[model samples]
Target: MAPAPRAQPSPVAVAADVSSAPVSTGCGNGGPTTHRGLAAATAASRTMYWPLLRNAECRHGLPAGLLDALVFQESRYRPLVVSRAGAGGLAQLMPRTAGDLGVINRFDAVANLDGGARYLRSMLDRYRSVPLALAAYNAGRGAVDRWGGLPLNRETPDYVRKVLTFFNEDA
Candidate 1:
């Protein structure tokens, strides 16, 4: 006799009302409690365009998870995100760097990611250390070389640690 076919599991159902709760107005009457849901939705949308992790991994030998971590640290995966220093896109490529990397459209998801990854790879090869490479990526290669290694700045140190931690966690 032939074995019986296995039944497919049914999809889980979520409560619609759960996402439509009342928000705290801080006055008296509550507003809409969709802040968490909205934030999550926004984040998911941002991740869709996070090309550094996806495109770089596909074309430039960069790790997707590392790219994701970098994007998280740089812009929290926000494609429209621009730094105070004028860096833009998911990977936060500076205008000059983006131009040098041949990123014609810095806002284009794929272009930005590829450019950032290539730049990162070049820095890594030059530094021969992930920490130093990341420091260079953040602070600049001249600064890294000037210090004879990674700088002793609190922000750079924390940034390196955070990226490494994210990398390790994802790995």
Candidate 2:
């Protein structure tokens, strides 16, 4: 038997994850909440990457706060973090994905952010659904196809919820 069709998330939930609307192209408009989220990160990391994040946002038409939320979840703004799965840099891109996205140096903050934003834009375009796109980002597109929605696995759903939480906080 096939898996049941998943219920679509509400529009507001989708928008909160990633909005196409023009907003200040930085994390949380430099609000107190944004600072609170970045409190764990070092000052240099926060200062150095905000502009790159903004640039990626403008170039990819992503909302900065959403992108910021994603980066926070992915690596906590640590440019050199390498996952056990070998995903690295601020975006935590895997090797194959980094190559496909034309990111030569995954540790290079600018390249990683740009590649991540580009890949995210493509996912959003392909799925036309924020949650599915986020699931695809976390668990890969093949899993999304196989599961017919968010996977039953714990990581993907938790990832979506956490990223959405950060995004909603405008962090």
Candidate 3:
């Protein structure tokens, strides 16, 4: 009788394989990003910023349209605004989320908008679709991820539609 030897992979090879795999950048849909794509995304943007979205946009590499849509949906550029749900500032970020995003004062227009934009960029990267990203932003990423799409939350759909339909004047 004869037996064959089984070979095991080396640690270096394994490490190489792991390192060579694609990594999520946590910006713009977890897909490849570029200033050009970002430029296109924000191409239709017409928002005025106290600190200017251009800086944040350049920092996180987000499409301007999506950012503008989110801002319009959340607070319509009112950094001092707060939702009944406790979302606040121009981006309508919750206190905890805002804090995690490095926003010391959510009511501050610059801080809020920057934190919100960063969060939205992450959502876009995670979901890879504008509607899904908007849904995650409105209903929480857990809900969108759990439902395998937009959550069943009543307001999520409306939020998504409103953000996506920013092109329509009446929207």
Candidate 4:
């Protein structure tokens, strides 16, 4: 007899884990609830991600807050997350991209932070602006290059806005 096939998880289920699975804050409100399909950047998460982020910043020539905000937007400091689009871990790195960055294990905090910071830094250096860099990070470089700036895609603008708000660049 042939082995039975396992059912694949629905996108909705994967997305719930990606954006809404609460990390233990050990505080009130159970680690802050997700609002608008994005996790809240709680103080607990900042404390957790700070050490790895700081080290990535120093080694990658990126600012700590920039990486933090991106992580806040990407995974909310959740290490085991896997996105509906198949991106994985804290940085939401796709497997191929992670491999290219020498990130053999996306769930590994230090490796993910370093790879993510390096990727973000390269995007920033290439685009020379926060919006463009963020758009590239979210929508890929080809999209930005074709659009000649931030693409008019629905999700990319909101993504940039969220990261900017967390980075305090929205002012």
Per lDDT, the best of the predicted structures is: 2
lDDT of 4 by residue, 78-159 (tens): 8888999988888889898899899999999889988998898788778666667777889998888776766666687778
> Which consecutive 10 residues in model 1 have the weakest lDDT in total?
10-19
Instruction: Give Cα-based local distance difference scores for all models.
Output: 0.63, 0.75, 0.62, 0.68
Q: Write the per-residue lDDT of candidate 3 for residues 67-111, one digit (tens) a residue.
A: 655776787666678899999877898988987888999987777
Segments of candidate 1 deviating more than 4 angstroms: 1-43, 50-52
TM-score per candidate, chains pooled: 0.71, 0.80, 0.67, 0.73
Best-fitting candidate, scored by TM-score: 2
The digit string of per-residue lDDT tens for model 2 on 80-144 reads 99998899999899999999999999999999999999888888777766677778888898888
Backbone collision count in every prediction? 2, 0, 7, 0
**Could you give me the TM-score of model 2 versus the true structure?**
0.80
Model 2, runs deviating above 4 Å: 1-44
Output the TM-score of candidate 4. 0.73
- Model 2, residue 57: what's the lDDT? 64
Off by over 4 Å in 4: 1-42, 169-171
Error of model 4, residue 7, in angstroms: 40
Better of 2 and 4 by lDDT: 2
